[model samples]
Target: MNSMSVWEATANERPKRPVLQGEKTCDVVIVGGGFTGLSVAYHLQQRNVETVVLEKGVVGGGASGRNGGEVLIGYVESMRSLAKKYGRAAARQMFQMSLDSIDLIERIIQEEDIACDFQRNGNLLAAYKPSHLDDLKREQQFLYEAYQFESKIVEKEDLHTELDSSFYHGAFVDERSAIFHPLNYCLGLAKAVERRGGTIYEHSQATKIERVTPDKVIVETHNGRIVAQQVGLFVNAYTTGLHDVIDRAIVPVESIVLATEPLPPALCQQLIKHNRAASDTKRLLYYFRRTADNRMVFGGSGRTASKRDARTLFDKLREGMVTVFPTLKDAKVEYKWSGKVGFTFERIPYIGQLEDGTHFAFGYAGHGAAMSTLLGKLVALNMLNEGDRHNPLDRSRLKPIPFHSQHARAVGIMKYYFKFLDYIS
Candidate 1:
């Protein structure tokens, strides 16, 4: 029962970086060395912009490495839900960008020669109930008719060939997505940034952000400070004690993950025979896949970040795993850990600059791998002014969450409502 995320435990050794010990300067200072910041840095270096990334912990120590590594296409919300919220045109445009983001990941991996076990086996969305299957059918139709996207809907009888489970009513499989070793990818991205003449400081957390002028900002860590013409804050759920307004804009949610010990190859084939990443159609959906080593990496159950009880959540996750695949009842979970991601209203991710002339990108609702990479590139474009500086995903500015202190309670209440909805459906 190790607390280490299977990603970090299995990833290649991350090079040790020195802490910032004195005043340093760069064209852009990026806070948080996770996916977004690294992506921004990587792109900035591509344009030969002097950049420095400061991470509170090691690279990929946050959700960048802790995620389920789905590398999924599109936003967390379905195309229908996105269309209903932001109109069909806007939703379609965003969907295209989301798809492009996956391309960016693939291109980078090939260009950088990063050995992260990158695979394009795609992903599956399973229907836990008959009604859920209907929803999947409608979603599949809407994707093709409205957005010109294609997905295959598997009937209940044929679901087992793909999922090896009789628990699901049906499934929707999208072949455009991918899965990989996220920690390795993050480390590779950092290496790419450095190879392009950028510096990344590990174990150096930005403690204070002081805006000296409209174009000058000073980011201070415990031992040193960074003076930069522009600053980008990519800290997602780990934004606490950085900026109150930015923190309030996001509702931090905990994501618990566990990886079972390597199963027999026969049992592994009895599981995900096609090796596609999968998630169910529940509000608190469980996302899982078979690792390169035949271990089942299953993750789900989000609570407010402040209310992380990994022990209980891990137990529930195991129970859910057994519920879906009874053959895993005796499987031993070798790794268990948890991390956080920003969840915004309407499940829309945000990217914007604050009043003090600092840029930021957050609010991914736990489905941020591709978006973070794309948003980081867009943010870099904003800094370089190469073209349109406007971000389609930006909501102008962040709206401070009302009753911020009671967010945990709100999440708790909503969890129950979602559970009920799952039950009835």
Candidate 2:
């Protein structure tokens, strides 16, 4: 069978609907029906809180569907950075929250019967240069000693047997991480939320948000308006013009991905021997892994700043994949696509409230599949009258993006500069 397009790969396969018509009122209104919005609705509905989720497109239609599907542990950046900024104890708690995200994901899949192809194949973080080996070693040591996590190191000679890539000098395998079908997972969450009696409207573009009072927010869609007691803006890259405050703090960069035709069992064995999700240790990097059916799902950004063309980006990704595994030269690429990833200056995610009764979470820094889900649940918990003083992951510690007005020009330039640095280094 031919590989499915990214849109059809693991779509919910539900009938698309037109915009919502009429006025609606809810305890809480969520914008952007991706992982975050779904999680919020799911958890809030479970708590018997009246909630409605509005999406401009279908569930998982945005980056939620376009991601690489790596269910990784930890935040966007290294835990070392967390320790540097906060204390070691705070960093440990933060790291534990990430680890807990993986567990929560697996539990949701099993308990909710989500058919997302979740697997425990683990993740392999490979180092491209010799200098990176020292960093990998330090990372491994830190994971083991400081974080109480275990990772196995693969030397250059052993890496070929495991990954069949000549570009890396060493690699660290974290057995705690996992991978899954991101779109399927997202759709499953949406369905679970619906099953719990929460309403979800697609093609429902939220154009206006007004603060009716200090505790009441009004969300206006094209066809209807929602008088929500509280509002949650889970929108990421698409936050542009929707929320002026969030748009300034988040930078949207393009992330492209491609999939090759299914390979023979022997060929898969020769390539990624363990069928692990693998990514190089670069800021702007390439991440490739074997699928359940033995296809090479490879992805990397282009030489240009943004992912403009699907065909051209796929061609560049094909070259990168072939460079790593020469045997795939004859293989046909079956799927290709791209999506926007939101990032902030700190490289950490932006999760907090605009003010009282308005919660927000975005800017995952290109790692959103699990983090988004986790943050959404936390947001729901925070909304349900939880004690923020005790919980370390409360919304207070995370700050909003700085210089919020200059985000478009400043973030674009920052992304281009980062891409340039990735090219040179």
Best by TM-score: 1
Candidate 2: tens digits of C-alpha lDDT, residues 1-425: 23344546646566554577898888999998999889989989998999999898888888888888888877666777678887788788778878888888998999999887788878888887767777778878887789778888889888886887787788988887888888889888988998898889998988988988876888998789888889888888877487666666677777778887778989987898877778987766889877777788887764244445555666777888898888899998878766788877676666666554568878787668778888888889878866244444444444546766666676557657867776666
Report lDDT per candidate: 0.87, 0.79
Pairs with backbone N, CA or C atoms under 3 Å apart (clashes), candidate 2? none
Candidate 2: Cα lDDT at 49: 94
List ranges where model 2 is wrong by over 4 Å: 1-7, 10-12, 302-312, 387-425
| lDDT measured at residue 56 in model 2 versus the true structure, 0 to 100 | 87
Each candidate's clash count: 0, 0
Q: What C-alpha lDDT does candidate 1 achieve relative to the native structure?
A: 0.87
- Cα deviation at 73, candidate 2, in Å, is 0.9
Please list the Cα RMSD from the true structure of every candidate, rounded to 1 decimal place: 1.7, 2.8
Best candidate per lDDT, number? Answer: 1
